[model samples]
Target: MTCQRGWQLAVLMFFPLFLAACAQTPGKGGEVPSAPPPPTVDNAQSSGDEAACRLDDIQYAVGMPLGDPSSDALARQGGAEQVRVLRPGEAATMDHRPGRLNIHLDDNDVIEELRCG
Candidate 1:
């Protein structure tokens, strides 16, 4: 029938236009857009004398059990203004702080490593 032919012709004509509309246009100068840059560590706290945490002084705390008294002493020894204890499978912020001490503990709650953030 003519009506059926008209519908088929209309679909054939519009299908290419629909596909062209969905096609991604090249960016400026015909170059594809690049992915965003990876995040960089914030250095605002590590500038000059602002870094008060010293990991070398608190390395002895590694392999020890993290108790309340020991945690306070370790923070003092490391000259850290803040202390963060991270246990296995625990979520922690990625932000780095030069004056903060990060204590990583194993599944047994024993200190595995000590580092200055």
Candidate 2:
């Protein structure tokens, strides 16, 4: 009888402990590690670690300080706004490459003339 009682108590304790153990993924500073935000992203005030991102017209933040593509139709339609990721320590050689913003990305970065600049 005591053995049966012991087994029941053990089962209860074991389940909760197992679940708790599986609950949290760890990361630097115990900050509950999260995925690095998508390389391409958008923000409200046009700022942050985000790479060269589109910010209506003349105001945009290029985190790593680089140039990228902007949409033609978008520009023609007056949306002239879009941005692409330009990681840190990276650069792009852009020219009057027509409606498409032609930029040369670094080794890792690609020459993606994404509709988004």
Candidate 3:
């Protein structure tokens, strides 16, 4: 009948529309939510204008913000090694041998001052 044809056409049209909508990510309550701000760290604690110092097997800097270890064996032995500027995905080693004024993430995990000779 005429009514059946109209219903079928409506269903066909609405199905495609519904699929298209489902493909997209819906916002909170059908509304786009505001993005949260990035977490920040205190820069004061980091090595401020400190020179990168490499000593013996240990390496570190004068002002590199260091993650205070919770009383570990290394601390008990004598003192843990120092921290120095390093590549984003690399460790502070002789091989890496970061040069002066190397852009690196600070001890606090935020990009800050670089190391210098």
Candidate whose lDDT is highest: 1
TM-score of each: 0.62, 0.25, 0.22
Per-residue CA lDDT of model 1 for 1-117, tens digit only, reads 999999999999999999999998889999998889999977654666555698888787787788844777898888988999899999999977778888899998899998877
Cα deviation in Å at residue 65, candidate 3?
30
Local distance difference test scores for all models: 0.85, 0.44, 0.45
**What tens digits encode model 3's per-residue C-alpha lDDT throughout 1-117?**
999999999999899888987786769789866779999966563444433432222223324443432212212232333334454667554433222333355446543443333
- Which candidate model has the greater lDDT, 1 or 2? 1
Residues forming the 10-long window of minimal summed lDDT in candidate 3:
69-78
Task: Report the poorest 10 consecutive residues by lDDT, candidate 2.
Answer: 58-67
Q: Can you give the lDDT of residue 114 in candidate 1? A: 88
Which portions of model 3 miss their true places by more than 4 Å?
1-30, 47-50, 54-117
